[model samples]
Target: MSHKDTIAAIATPPGNGGVGIVRISGGQLESVARGLLGRDLPQPRIAQYSSFIDAHNNTIDTGLALYFPAPHSFTGENILELQAHGGAVILGLLLERALQLGCRQARAGEFSERAFLNGKLDLVQAEAIADLISSSSARGARAAQRSLSGVFSARVNALVAEITSIRVFVEAAIDFPEEEIDFLADSDIQQRLQQVIDDIETLIVEAHQGRLLRDGIELAIVGRPNAGKSSLLNALAGDELAIVTDIPGTTRDVVRQQILIDGLPVFVADTAGLRESEDVIEAEGVRRALQIQEKADLVLLVLDASTETPENLPVIPDPKRTIIVWNKQDLVAGEMPLAITKGLDSVIISIHNTSGLDVLKQKIRQHAGLNEASEGVFSARARHLDALHRSEKLCRHGLAQLQDFSAPELLAEDLRQAQQVLAEITGQFSSDDLLGEIFSSFCIGK
Candidate 1:
């Protein structure tokens, strides 16, 4: 797992600041450090002020040089960190000197990738490092930190162990065809299998919640012209993000705003009113609105409470994913029509007065699957969810095969496949292409 050549990069962001760091990792750290510092390297894990010397023995800069010997560094290799002035030119000069000293520029996410290869971190933890750096909210950063601390990996590993134990039992049964039926029928075996399946299902749900924290949710606002869609967007965002006009079709395109609800990111899109229009631009807006609704996690169907419910309200593809919003409630003198309000999932509010906005926000949070208890949830990605789902499906299929009592070998194979699928979540069974694709998306110097 050791790298023969050294890799170096400016770990700090590409900007001038009080300080910047140039990080190096590889087997040749001592040699490279000697070449750059023109002196004995600092003691292991100790920072020492030193003059950075270049090829011609000219002093390039003066900074703190800290060295960490192999097996105890971030990448499990000899690591050297140069803390220097934050000037971009200074960092570039230091990087160039390192490259001249036999180290090359580190690729994007290479440091974390090396950590994964060296067993310093698992795939999930490696990804969590990137997630933690990119998190947009405090809650999200905390969740990613939990994942980096192995909260998510521990759960996955526990599930993997359960699968391994069950697979061992199933495979043992398969070896003795005559006793296989009885073995599968054992109450303990059936219970263990069901328990594992249930645990996988639970993990899937929690991972989904974690994914929402990491990736956020998309809420599409859709309604007839002048139904306060723009007003609702403005209210949720706490700013006038969209133009509100009494004129129909004022908004002829999609306007998006990112707002946080209870520390969870929500991307709200205010689209043109869903209505039949002769104007080409207006028609296109309606088309885009409908398209966004089809893909949105939740759709806010805004209805003007001051006016009678429009008979031609846009069809909600999934009622469960749609929130009926009755806006302009302040203009209504009496109670809302029972026919429109009763037996329907709806929230009434006034955008001008901000009435019932809290309830709407709460609803959005509820729909996004976030709560006060989410503090402990670990961040997850769509790929992790996909792997979990595949594992769950395979586990269920294996259980069904056991129930049929005709194909013990098939059940054993199913369990084996399920175990492998779950293993991919932690990089124990991942393809190189998947690893490449995942790391390539990370920012350079991560």
Candidate 2:
């Protein structure tokens, strides 16, 4: 529970490999290292060939021992890393030996949590460390690295500095009520506020792209029975993940697939065909399909172009988030119907022939705002976006108060709230519960 507790864990992954690492961190690391190495702690930051010993002075393994002193280590504490033959049993014995030497087993993410608490890294950077380790693509890893290097934190800190300055000015003006200088009505202050708002808007857009790269997007494919929903899923996923048949309701459950588009993951769920059914199981599948459609970031309404015109369809998807996919276009007699395409984004595709699938994929990427150049994007999480949105809303509300009501006090309060909300992104303002929830997702030994 406390940073003073010397913690140790097997840093390497499970199973046998070429080498394994047992990491230790705490104020007591110096003596612990001496106990394990059977001699004085090695020169700081240098790897020394030594024998890892057990409690009875028996050599457990012969490998390299690396020591890092306090104030310059990853966790801002004395640290030791033991590199030995990478076998599950060997690593376990080494970790057990450290526990015998006054070190407790580290919980998941305890090391990075310590780094955050010790000021060596902020919450964003600490989270980025985990993100980097779990990244699925090179681009995602680069984005996480950008966040870890303080790119995102620097932008947030800049916003906080500006807001703090404005708050100080407004509070100062409120204190001097007798002054004729109308600071609240000053055009310069309003312009500065507006500029900050614009910057936040821009940051929000970039963070959204970063989030897509990190968490990806959920796409639900839904439509009436026998509309080639499973065919489209197979085409997109490049595998026969779902059964494609002429029979209606062939897919009685949702079939999920992970499709990568230029390093961005797309979790595509091919849900059961939506239609009225007498069978209880088929009806349940239809109900679950609707639920997935509602929750998905984008819904693909696959329509059978060969059967009927687009206007005659009984159900219409939410135009804002749904893409009308007119499938089986190869069977259509003439050019596609132009009606019912005015409001929503629709595409003509032949899943059987694999036509227009590229366009569909591009539309998906565009919907996620990831079709653009992603250079310099810093990875972001849902919480970061939520905080940014809340902060932006508060700033907008404060601007309204200043402009419409000329209420400096209300505007000042709004600014304070906005500042605090922004601070949460970097852990400047965070509760213990939030910290625990965030770090607990990280793998142990991080």
Candidate 3:
């Protein structure tokens, strides 16, 4: 775990490829490279062709050797990369040779961990590396790239700078009581505090969108028997993911499918129809349907327009997060029922005709808080949102203390707390445990 110890790992994936790399990073990289390459360090940042040698001077594999001197490498330490034939056994032998040369195998994310410890990268950027690698969509990859390039960090640092200035001003007012200046009531102080609050609000909104893009949404399609729930799922996914039939309870279990809606992944689960049935299998399906509904981020209540009346519409849980979709629009002879509207977002769509599905998708996208414009979107995690929310709460509480209680001291302390919470986002103030939990999720030799 200590950065002082040299670490080496096969940087390539665990399969045979055209080329494989063994990455070494630490202070002792120079000696390790000499032992493996049997030559003086290659020119810095230059890929020199060389033959890797064993302890007995036996030629292992001839490829390119790259060297990055300390303070300029990915880990802010001396780094050596050996490019050899990508056979699994060859890469393993190369890694083993480095281990014999006094290098230990790197733990998961050790490279990025070293970079973070050495001030080469902030916590957000360090996390962005993994996000970028695992992004499923093009937009997601672009957003993660922005975060890795420090766009997200810049926003967080700007807020931290503002908070620092406020603390200094407030503390200064408290320190000099002889001036008899009511700093808490001063219009300038109020304006500055309000501006900071406003800025934090904006950041929170953007961070929310980033989180949705990173984590996506969980959507469950639930309704009574023969309500075209399976049809809607197929339409959204643009594939035959679920079996459709005229027989009730055709889908006896939950069928899951993932679809990208404008770069945001939506995990759609088509659950069995919700109805009371004496059959054991059907009844279990109904139970599971209710369970999925409780855990889903958004629920689509599909109702057959021809058979379902407004008065018979099932009571939905969490009406705000639920969308009522009246399906089979073509079957209904006259105007559709409008009485079921309970302020919930409702759409009338004929899954057979492929009509109104776009509106349904738009509603789902709105649920995720992602607009058509993807500008300024960055990769974020749940922890970032949590920190932002706590910071905002502290700022609001501090403002309340200053305005209502006229307690400048209390306001200053709240501001400090807010500052600390925001610092956690950028790793300025973080615990070893939090750092371990975060980086451990990353792949080794990151």
Candidate 4:
């Protein structure tokens, strides 16, 4: 499945460093090597000390040249690696020289696509590589590492096997005519179908947790203009990101800050105060705050802890996950005192005094399912979840068909499509279109 393009790229980041690498892969490795090496290249998979010369046959820079032969190399093609001194000017010169020697610059994610096509990695593993690169939490990183090692793929494969076996049995029963036992009435068939359903249920739970690890939790901060909304942001961010002022309406627009809490990424957005305003600008700001709150994973409805109650909150609908925060206790009693009977199962805190922030953190951790993410959590993507949902619906439909119509052909057909849907999780049933979409998300040079 490998392509024929001679792709090349700067393997290291774009900057000056101790060393840089220029990676190349194609079907014409020998010709490219001979043209640059000024002599016959060494056999595949062996590194040789060599000097890179220009078109005019003058010395450029000397480095180790390693050649990996086709079918055994990454991308299942001929591969070459040139180690050179790290310098922007130096690396740019090398890249320009290679283009002059019949190599083309690779597009984003081409190398990883090649690896996927060559069977070095399935789609799940390829995606896990991206997850590992962008992991925000230690828990996230560990789960992604497990996914890259095929933990997630193995589970998918197991489910696919179970589905295939069930389909085979249904198909066989359909082929046999005049049997005394009806396939649908058999207790064995019912038991097997139920088992598949149970397995899917378990996977969906784990996959949902994994999705959170990859996408992170979105948090919204809403309150009156001066109820320490900005201060809460500044304190959690460890930087003066939001403008803190006693003046109301100091922040008319949402101020977004990305903060890591115990290694978990929380995108805390400090929104405009939710209150009636005479100014046109303040009215628009409040409207925008309502919009962001709708999509927040957790909403921190901030109120003045000194004397404010839940009734002080704006007329926003209660989100599925809400962590009520009573801020500005520093001005009230110098310490936050929690009273559960105040109507909100919330936490009280002082942004300036830094009291009760720990309680807020604990609440956030619990709301995000991080409190239960220590074990059995694997990295998953939205696409994987969608596929599972599709398979799940089809399984339900097939079960109904089996019990009602006694249609073995219909049951077999559903199971077949179900297997394909499940296989997409591990990329066993991927189309070129799906592959293109998947690989296009990666950075060039992988």
Candidate 5:
């Protein structure tokens, strides 16, 4: 818990700007400040415009220096901020001066890591800061903000408390043994377990939606050549990102466009026509299309309504996860066997006339399991999802042990393991390697 040494770095983004900031955090900030300012002016939270002199009392650069005392500042340690005119050289000079004063340069994400260590922010909040910074949509940003504000952590903590209460009762029954007979028969215990399961399921649904927001959905467009694949891509993206031509085999490679629909990031991949071909390039494209379909969250099956029915529509992976889009529907008069695979399958649309595109977009959102009308969702990484899944599985195992009236010790052991997995999600109990791996992903100076 006792972190040694001071870490310093230019906190602002790279490149020249009107102004830039260099930040330092740790124990030796006061001494480092005194050395650079040539005097002790550690007025916590007060800006002191001073010269950034070196150990030899030579001016490094003039800047406004501010200090934040421990337990109140970011990283939960003494922090120093040097705000200087935005110049790569000026910030570089300031950083060099700090390093000379025995302050090591800050590592990527170190500041957030320190915040986690000092209990200023939990693991979820720390990750949210990154998500907020890199959010692609307004909704995603808002979700990250809620997570950073501890909304997600609060919910997780409440669930953990609920689990703990159940665990305590189960363990107590094992120890007392006298109450064991009646305890196993109590319906209250079963009710509490069921309620907890319901809560976990709800969280899983919400978190999965949030995950889609963060990771976005991968959609692959497939059909025979001249099926209006490029046109559909251009229409959805609202730009001519992919080459659009009337030729049957115009697109020879997979063209990808990332666009936001209803504030959800969607990767629209326009692939070459899915069919046997003699051209080497077209063959490669076809192969790539199949591969993309395997991992795609949804497949936009574009069928040219102007032409004959597609004799061989590509076999979609996870049919439940696909939406068969009948494009160029305007060419045909009315619906003709529009069912792609039944009610759970497809939708008809006219990309040429821009008809039914709204319906198509809505369907995409639904396929992603996203509630587009959602007021808010907490951003969660795949790692958090993994942890939650493992915790849920173990909890269910514990529930089974209880229902069967098996050995109480078996139930207790499962609960203990489940608790540890949940604890890891919030950083309640963490390993050094995990800490290192998480923080190292951040850019220097956080």
Candidate 6:
């Protein structure tokens, strides 16, 4: 895990700030530090005010230099950090001076990658660092922090241990057939297998919630012309984001607005009114609206309560995924229409007066599967969800084989495959390409 060459980069964000940092990590940090500081390295883990000198022995910048000796640094190598005034020119000069001292620029996520390679962090923890940095919501950030603290990893490891114990027992029974233990027929073995399946199922549900937190749900608004589609977008966004007019087909393109519904991020897309139009642009807009509707996690079907009914509306491809919103309640006289209020998934609201908006927000949160209980969940990526799903499927298949056909060998193989799939989450069985892909997405100097 030891690197031969030194790597350096401007650790802080690019811009003017109160202070900036140039970090270097590798075996040659001692020489790098001495060359830049123009003096002997400071005591390990202590910050010393020093002058950053160039190769010509001219002072490039005055900064605080902190040194961390080998085996005690973030990358598990000798590390040096130079904190200088937050000026682009000064930071560039410091970085250039370090490069002159035989240090190369670090790539995107190289610091975290080195940490993972040196056994300082597991795959989940390393990825959690990136997730924490890129999180858009406060709840998402907290969830990522929990994952970084090893809450998620500990759970995965416990499951791995349980599966490993079962595999060992099954393999032993296969190897020692004359023991007369009847391992396959034992009720204890069956119970253990069932418990493992149950655990996997539970984890899958939690992971799905975590993934939703990490990547918020997409909601598409669709309906015929002048059905308050644009009005609803502006109302949800709490501003005039989309143009509203009495004329139909005013919005010829999709208008997107990202809003937080009860701490849960909801990407709301207001699409063009669905209708047959002779105008070329409107027809294209209608086509794009349909495309967005198909890909959305949920579709809000806006209806003009003043006139339109469910029977006259366009057929929804999936009624379960569609929420019927009765808009213009202010224009309607007397009680709400039976067609709009009859359905459990329907909500009556007036975009002009902002009535029933709270109920609509709650419905959005409910449909997104996020609630107060999700506060304790950890952040997870789509890839992690995919792995968990595969592992769970394998475990269920193994359980079925053992229970119905009494095929111990097939069951053992299924368990092994499940174990391997789960191992990928923690990098125990991850491929090199997968590692590269994961780290490549991280920001530089992470």
Candidate 3: C-alpha lDDT: 0.90
lDDT of each: 0.88, 0.90, 0.90, 0.82, 0.83, 0.87
Task: Estimate, for each residue in 124-165, the C-alpha lDDT of model 6 and write its tens digit.
Answer: 999999989988888888889999998888888988899999
Q: Give the per-residue lDDT of model 2 (tens digit) for 260-329.
A: 8888989999988887889999999999999899899999999888885555574766777889898999
- Candidate 4 per-residue lDDT over residues 218-337, each given as its tens digit: 999987778888888988888999888878888888999888776567899998888889999999999988888988888888877676654664554564477778777667755454
The residue-by-residue lDDT of candidate 3 on 207-321, one tens digit each, is: 8888888889999999989999999889888898899999998998899998999899999999999888999999999999999999999999999988996666776879878
Predicted structure 2: clash tally? 0
Q: Is candidate 3 or candidate 5 better by lDDT?
A: 3
Weakest lDDT window of 10 consecutive positions for candidate 4: 333-342
lDDT of 5 by residue, 292-396 (tens): 878887888777655644356566567787777777777787665555346647777877678889998999898888895667698987878888888888888
Task: Please give the lDDT score at residue 209 for candidate 1.
Answer: 81
lDDT digits (tens) for residues 107-126 of candidate 1: 88888988898999999999
What residue runs in model 3 are displaced by over 4 Å at the alpha carbon? Answer: none
Candidate 2: list runs displaced more than 4 Å: 310-314, 338-342
TM-score of each: 0.96, 0.96, 0.96, 0.92, 0.95, 0.97
lDDT of 4: 0.82
TM-score of 3: 0.96
lDDT of 4 at 355: 86
Badly placed stretches (over 4 Å) of model 1 are 177-181, 310-312
Clashing pairs in 4: none
